[model samples]
Target: MKNKKILLAVCGSVSFYKAYEIISLLKSEGADVRVMLSDGALRFANLISFEALVQNRVLSSISEDWQSGLNHINYSKNDLIIIAPASANTINKIAHGVADNVFLQTILASTCPKLIAPAANNNMLENFTTKNSLEILSKNGYDICEPVSKILACGDLGKGALADPQIIVEMAKRTLNQDNFYKGKKVVVTGGATTEKIDDVRGITNFSSGKMAKALADAFYYAGAELTFISSNEFSAPYPIIKFSSSEELLNAINSQNLSQNDLLVMCAAVSDYKPKTKFNGKMKKSQNELNLELVLNTDILKSLNLNCKKIGFKMEMDRALAKQNAINMLNSKNLNAVCLNVLDEKIKFGSDQTKIDFITPNGEFDTGFDTKPNIAQKITELAKQI
Candidate 1:
């Protein structure tokens, strides 16, 4: 939770007061908390008190930021959104995609992981409409933290009070554990330059140092994705590595994994485009100055792989004007789900820590400005979640 972002959407309910305790609990866990209060909640919720803990203005219907709906869109990008003290009104609206208030609008706008913790009077919670809304939300992928039997603020004992703040925090943890986009997803990454041996001591390779591969691997690991690293070069990681020295070995390594359409693969390796027409098993005598060797095309791993899973390729471009078009062409021609385009000494270069890349897909292109490899890798990881 050290750097995790949490969005707490509070609805108008007697349990609204408990959002403070929940915020305190989450802060104790080191989470970065942002609060969004519904119009109904504004009556009981004091803006000044919330501002002290959130360190920002609480999102509300009256906020000027909602004019273009930008605030809701941006705030919804958090790692997790929790509707604590979810009232019957909010719960029903959420189930049906009705966006009357800021909270409901943000819920509809976000595809990130979310939790709905319903809190209302016992009769309100038991109504057929309320019960059905809760069911619909649960079936639609929102985690529902069912209320526990407790003494209500109205002097009645029932199972409709907002769950204990501690329980809501724990449920938040469990929700993130299960719904983090990359969590438990399988990902295969290819790196290093593929080699083609002309002789035992003479081989061909590219300028790839596999630095980006390590960075990506680290990013995916932190993101909770199950990882498989494929490379000819050695690198240290906590995940398993399947080593290969040639295009054939690399293909075999990929094919051996039994990957499926649900998995993801990133082709960052600078594989040789051509190989020697005739490879020599033994070292040749100092080849004559006029020595000649025929070259032939190597297998197109990206196109030839027998995979249905989403695949992303790295396209290296030497010209800026043609870079984006080239990447789009590669995306289509190579049958890739997306392509990351890097131009030599411009957007990206060999052996550099930082990079600027354009993420191109059939939909469009997203240009990531100059940034560290790790930061770029994290951005790519986010894109991977969608693709």
Candidate 2:
């Protein structure tokens, strides 16, 4: 990560102090570092401390230096932008393209890859509105360094804490170093089944173990693409994992990923098509009588995606001919570059280790034959490189 230009954008939060440590770490690693603070962040962060550690003046909302007028515009030339301890206000503003302050204005002007590490109270992290804002940021191609679950400044213990400076730096290094075909490529992968809530405890879902999604993510990572893996399953991987539970949540996850015209989106998740019209906050008591549940169409993620990227959709059907047609229709309807079709059968169980799939691209369809998930993933990775 040496010889790299990095801008450390600090936001208002108890975790503002972490920015100093990050600056120190990045500088020691031979990176040219600059610091900027938001209005709220200035209250918690001592600008002098950052200047002393980074050997440069800190830029803030009231900055009047020679470059103050064109700071945001000129700073767009930097290689990377990182928002440490990103406050709810800053995240919300940036997600919606609000550039009122120096920090946000600079971000809007820069076309470089941005990494965001959010810090706030547990309630704020869990808030539906805040969650949606974060999603929007992702869809705009911002890399979200999700907060970890920990005891925050408040007494409540949950997610809303800034990650360790060491971990943040490591992620930054990975983001900046891309030497393969996937170099600078933004690849978003969605996997697993989305659950529809009937009550607080019960819901409906599809059969998906997310094994194939994991395989595909690993392939993308090894190929050197900036990978964002969204899953409905619980597991650990080397890449950043964004997990969602419902169809709406999955849509938000997909929408939030930072995808560019050169990026690739692989839609492999088994999302629900419908959900209960009304859901009880608390568990409903079981009665002896027959109960009918009202269902509504869930948002179609593929239809909702608005990013300019190479898109691949997945379709599964029992009949081979129907599956081919389904894949072609999905490809044409969504303006996707390719579609992966699977013929389901007794041997191809939900969690099966092997299955047959076809790659239906604009050039035509190519069958991979019956193969293991890993093998299929490798094939998919190669196909992605071609497009």
Candidate 3:
């Protein structure tokens, strides 16, 4: 995103505060960010705070930059327009082509990719008018960042919270990097630890933060792949997400996707190797001193997947010396095009931000020295495209 000009339009939602982190993320990626605020946004966001981060005067009204005479038109010249925390009212106005505010007026004049992140109360967001307007905007080529279901500021648990700042930024990068290479490519990334239910409340799982999978997902999205993230954890993305718990459930979810040979599947989830043979009907009582439960092997998801798509799998081992060998073994056993080897010991922590990976392909082993997950993910993404 270096040197890319971006215009961030903040609306009236209380969640407009999130724009701070959004700005920081974009600037950190070397984007030239300029902010435009709605009148209602002033109540929750300070112009000075925005100006300080962007290192430029914030624009709130059309009259402020009158010296240029084409201020609105010029603002519309950004490489991308992001309407974060796009309130329902603003959405409706945009749907009806009402460019009353400078933000909307500039958007009207802009032909650049537009990304909208809607945030509002449930009733407001689900209202007929609001829903209709969103549908209209989506049909008009606007990239809508679907809100996650969470407890709102109004104390209601529903689907109206603004998307994660990371996801919003990733979607913006995707919009900016939309190109021929990955434009229509399908990428499926599996994540999180799949659980084997022992009872309604208890289950066995692993220590996976899903960050590795998330990094892969984000990298693929930024590369413009049509993305789908299958995970046990809840997430908000501008693509499809299939939720699952047990290894069986995960397999079923992946099967449901109907992947083709053109697709790319990254198997990074920590799927349970064994499941309780006899799952208790409900919560297992602790009355017994010791419970000797029988275990059964779970079907290897990667090997069991009924598709011919090119696949890359993750192999996490305890010994650094044996990690590459184990990854290579899994690569052949699981019929994978490549495998990523991660050694977990005192120095390496699970579910963390940083990772040192070794990539084993049919060709040879390449050690990717210690680096942040995002950087490693980018390298893996580039490797996958070449394969």
Candidate 4:
């Protein structure tokens, strides 16, 4: 652990005092630690405290003198970067690529893994703006540690407490070790909502956050797989990813690749089923509120791959009764080794961190209760090993 360099960014919150404890914990674990504090964070906890705890310079702004030319670039060069007690404003800034401050600048410059433990008022954390920002950050490959429900500093009881220091430290360690699993084998993951274009600027799409696909890719990487992630526009993956925007583009990407029988293909993309029959050369002019549009069915990429190679497919459904039956039918029809079935009714299918899935095979079905997407991917990979 001592060989692992960790850059800790402290943000403003009543829980900012706990940041010192985190520093001490990480140091005890023998991790090389550097500390950066946000301007608002310094109000709750002074820079002197962090310097004493980590025995390193505490950076607060870009103007701070350092041995390196740009502290942000230097700070970004670490194995892992974590922001504990992340304020709503801080998260927003990071999501938007705002580099006005040292913390945001370092985050923007960072290629290393990032983890954010939010610590703010429950209302603030739950606000639509904050949630959207977090979604964007997660889609961009940031690990979010959800705050615990506890008594607030303002005397309110709800979810907004910083996660336990131990939990945060362990998560950081796991993230750093993610590369160890990808030593061999080939893995492929598809992500994002593939557009079935209706016109020059319009199309049909689904609400695929690409989190599940990203998680699957991350898991395969950690499980010793040479990873090739094919995604649309979503970008929450922390690996070399290939991008595509349409169903045809995705199909072409898959078909053009030289895939082997030993390779594992996880079809997690929510591709559109149909496209417009007539594509306008330019943006369609607005006339009547109601207009008829001719549609054509898009190629089923997963089904096509299923016929030629062994693959894992995903089925997102709302009805439980239909899910198992549909999963089994799809598995057999598509010649899949296994299918992961999930329900969108509980909001587990998209735009959320936690999810529940049922793993289905021809012989039996296994219920994997609600869990983090990473853990679910782990379970899926383990199950794949059995087959």
Q: What does the lDDT come to for candidate 4?
A: 0.81
Q: Give candidate 1's error at residue 342 in angstroms.
A: 0.8
Task: Give the clash count for model 4.
Answer: 4
lDDT of 2 at 323: 75
Task: Identify the superior model by lDDT, candidate 2 or candidate 3.
Answer: 3
Worst 10 residues of 4 by lDDT: 177-186
Task: Name every residue pair that clashes in candidate 3.
Answer: none
- Candidate 1 local lDDT, 1-387, one digit each (tens): 666899899988988889999999989988999899889998887777888987866777766385654478877888999999899988988888898766777889988888889898899999999999999988888878889788899988998988878768866765675437776678889888888999988887889888887777767765767788998788755567889888889988887776678788888888999999998888888757788889999998987788778899998878789888878888989889889888887546788999887888888778888999888988898887667
RMSD score of candidate 4 (Å): 15.1
Best model per TM-score: 3
TM-score of each: 0.55, 0.55, 0.75, 0.57
Give me the runs in candidate 2 sitting further than 4 Å from their true place.
1-179
- What TM-score would you give candidate 3 relative to the actual structure? 0.75
Give candidate 4's TM-score.
0.57
Error of 3 at 387 (Å): 2.0
lDDT for each residue of candidate 3 in 62-103, tens digit (9 for 90 to 100): 335777553677788889999998999999999899998787
Per-model C-alpha lDDT, please?
Answer: 0.83, 0.83, 0.87, 0.81
Which is superior by TM-score, 2 or 3? 3
